[model samples]
Target: MNSLFLAFIGVGMMAAGFALYSRFLGSKVYRLSAKYATPAHTMEDGVDFVPTNKYVLWGHHFTSVAGAAPIIGPAVAVIWGWVPAFLWVTLGTVFFAGMHDLGVLWASLRHRGQSIGTLSGRYIGARGRNLFLVIIFLLLLMVNTAFATVISKLLVSTPTAVIPTWGAIVVALLIGQAIYRFKWNLPAVSVVGVVSLYTLMVVGDRFPIVLPETVMGIPDRGVWIILLFTYAFAASLLPVWVLLQPRDYINGLQLFVGLIILYGSVLITHPDVVAPTFNDNVPEGTPGIFPLLFVTIACGAVSGFHGVVASGTSSKQLDKETDARFVGYFGAVGEGLLSLGTIIATTAGFKTLANWEEVYNEWSAGGVNAFISGGGSIINEGLGIPTSLSATILATMAILFAATTMDSGVRLQRMVVEEIGQIMGLKISALVATIIAVGVAFALTFSSGADGSGGMLIWPLFGTTNQLMAGLSMAIIAVILTHLRRPAWPVLIPLCFVVTVAMWAALLQLGTLWAGRNWLLLGIDVVIIIAAIWVVVESASAIMRARKAPAVAWSDADTDAPAPHHVG
Candidate 1:
């Protein structure tokens, strides 16, 4: 089949899902109300809570959640077959992730922008809240470590990407300063920021920035990893407007531009699907597609992490309740599109089936390289650009995506850690909490694994945990729906599906880790399974309690007021 046809089908499905299905979800299922003053206005603090434009907020939310995981996950999962990866990205985004993201954002908005972790307490209990926070902390830690490792590895492998990657950061800092400090026009600054970053990409392609073999006696990758985490630590410590928000805004534009190039390339090149739809050349000990594919493609299809971002930062800045549909639902659709691009590039960009097989043979490393190569090939063919420069640009984009995630992940981790500290009655400063969070992530990144896989070694755990978090977020939203006497099926159905798939995948991973005697990962898997069960039980109990209690009337004032139970 023509890859362009497949790509169009996927993109068309997402567009229809956004226009029709998501609209139904917003109007019927979620019933978002503009009458209710959002926390951004009601709880405007100017630091964490501030009213914002929907378009700008959507950019922040989308880029923050659309990390390298979506790319890496689909890139890896296509090894099983493009069919499973493509189907899951298409269906999961519309049905599962969209609902989950929208529901959580709505629930958070209705609860004064409290995070999903804090909402668990109101809906489930204080114990569930603690459990939720712990799970979130660990999940964010994995995210930080994995992204740091991935970005460092990319920089080390593709030296040309190094300059553009760091150059973008510098550009982001300048953009942030210019917009906030000088009161520069955002659109103007954004265009300049995007142009500056891409110019750096072109220059870096010609004069690549290669690091020495050893930096302070550490391997180049290790040095890059350490340096990346150090940068993450500093980025986490900075205020959102100065760095996090503006940087994501710029990176979001980069992503938007990159996607246009990729999709246009696909349409122009009209490549055939060279990769097999279903391949039995499975790697030894890899889990089957049944549950693994769902977990593997978490970000594109339906990520629990999106729920985190929605409730964590996006909800706080939501200017109107009505914008949740645009910010939350469409953010998910954007991620699905990225995932679809990944599927198409990985499947069709290969020159020959044999070449594709050779790349897929070593699942982890090959998957990453194949996506870059294939994506670069398509862009080159479409734009008449040189393959090497196009590949470098794509690699630079990947590095930026990963870096953005790491930047956000470490910052989120700091918040989670501080929340945990607050729960424990510890008065740790943000700097201390951030240092602790970065320390743990750094340790985990350097930990031993086969062939020094580092974060890759525990990617399965990360994927399962991410999906489980999504399931848990859905469970919280379901409880909220039950309390409000609203239809709970929208949230409950996705919750059940994610929990089941995540649990199944987790068990398979536990066995794999045990057989390999990877005690650390084995223990982490066991704890994750236990945590999943606890969340399920807590959600069920919340539902039962809601059934017994009388339905509460919806009031805008009540939603805008701070909940007594909000610890974060």
Candidate 2:
């Protein structure tokens, strides 16, 4: 079948899900109301609590959550075949991730913009809140370490991407000044910012920048990872409007443009799907597709990480309660679209089945490399762009995606650590808290699994932990709904599904790690399982208590009510 046909089918399915299913979720399930005053307005503080435009907030939310996981997960999970990956990205985004994100955002909005980690105290009790904070801190730490390694490896392998990646940061800084300082029009600035970044890509392709292995007698990748964490530390310390928001806005626009080019190229080229829809000839030790595929494609389909981003940062900036549906649900749909593009690009971009098989024969060789080559081939054939330039552009995209995630992850980690400190009555400065967070991430990057392969040793835990986090967030939302006398099925159903799949996947991984005697990963896996159980038990208890207590006539839609106790 022609690649464009598959693209249309996938895109059409996602659009329909957004229109029909998501609309139903918003109106019937979530019942988003414009009447409620958001934290951004109620707690307007000119810093983290400033109210933001819906469109800009959507861009920030989407790009922050988009990260490298969506691309990496789908690209890797396509090993089973495109059909499974496509279905999951389509249905999972609509039913699972969309609801998860929207519900958490609403939960946070109703609770004074406190992150899910902190909100656990109100809904799940003090102990639940403490455990949730620990889980969130570890999850964000893993995110930082993993993405730092990912960005460094990409830069090392694709030297041409180095210049453009850094160039985009410089552009973002300028764009930030233009928008915030000079009050420049956002659309014009965004267009110029994106165009300038793409121009840098062309320049980079012609003059690739290669960094030396050692600045002063150190491994290059290690140095790069340290430099990245350093940047994250600084970026996290800056206010949201200064660097984080503007940078993510520019990157978000770049992603949209890249997707259009990719999908348009598919239409022009009409390439064939050389790979099969379902490949029964499996690798020897590959886990079955049932639970493994679900967890493997976490972000593309329905990542728990999205829930954290929703409740952690995005909820604080929302201008009104009703925008949660748009920012949360549509953000998920946007990720689903990206995943669909990955499926199409990987399955059909190659000229022959043998070439595709060779690239995908091993998981290590596939991932971002395969997607870049294959997607670049399609763009080259369709748009007459040189394959080298196309590959450079794609590589830059992957690097930026990872870098954006790292920036946001570091910031979230700092907030989590500080929250924990406050709960424990330890007075920690923002600088000290940020350093501690970055230090932990830096240490993890060099742990025993650091086999010079860019933290691949700890990657297995990322997906499961991410899904478990989503399950935990959804559990919190479910209990909150029950307390408010709202329908809890929308959130509860997805929570159960995520917890089941994640537990299964984690157990499977634990067995392998135990046999291999990889104590670090094995220990991490056990903690994840325990965390899942703790959250579920807490949620169940909260639900039972809510049932026995009198309904407090609490409506999230009430805009005139006094705000809850402010934490940060």
Residue pairs in clash, model 1: 304-470
RMSD of 1: 2.4
RMSD of 2: 2.5
TM-score of 1: 0.95
lDDT (Cα, tens digit) per residue for candidate 1, span 1-568: 7898888799899889889988988887778888898888888876678787687788788888887888888999998888888889999988888888888899889888888998897778888888888789878877877777778778878888878888887888898789767988888998999899889888888888777887667778888887888888888877676777787888888888998999999888889998888978766755577887888889998888888888888899898899999999898998898888888889888888888887877646455677899999889988888898888878887888778777778877877888888888998888899889988877777776321247665666888899999999998877767766787787787788889989998998888888899998898889878878997898898788777877756776575534322123
User: Candidate 2 on 1-568: residue-level lDDT in tens?
Assistant: 6788878887887778778877787777667778778888888776677787777788788888988888888888888887888889888987888888888888788778888987777777788888888778878877888888888888888888888988887998898789878999988998899999999999999998777767776577877787788889999888787888888888888988899989989989889988878978655666689888888888868887887788778988998787888888888888888888888888898989888888888653458877898889999998999999999988998899889888888888888888989998998888999999988888778874332343566777888888888988888877766665678888888888889998898898888999999998898788778877887898887788877766645566554322222211
Runs in model 2 lying further than 4 Å from the true structure: 448-454, 555-568
Worst 10 residues of 1 by lDDT: 559-568
Instruction: Report the number of the highest-lDDT candidate.
Output: 1
- TM-scores across all candidates? 0.95, 0.95
Error of 1 at 246 (Å): 1.1
* Model 2 poorest 10 in a row by lDDT: 559-568
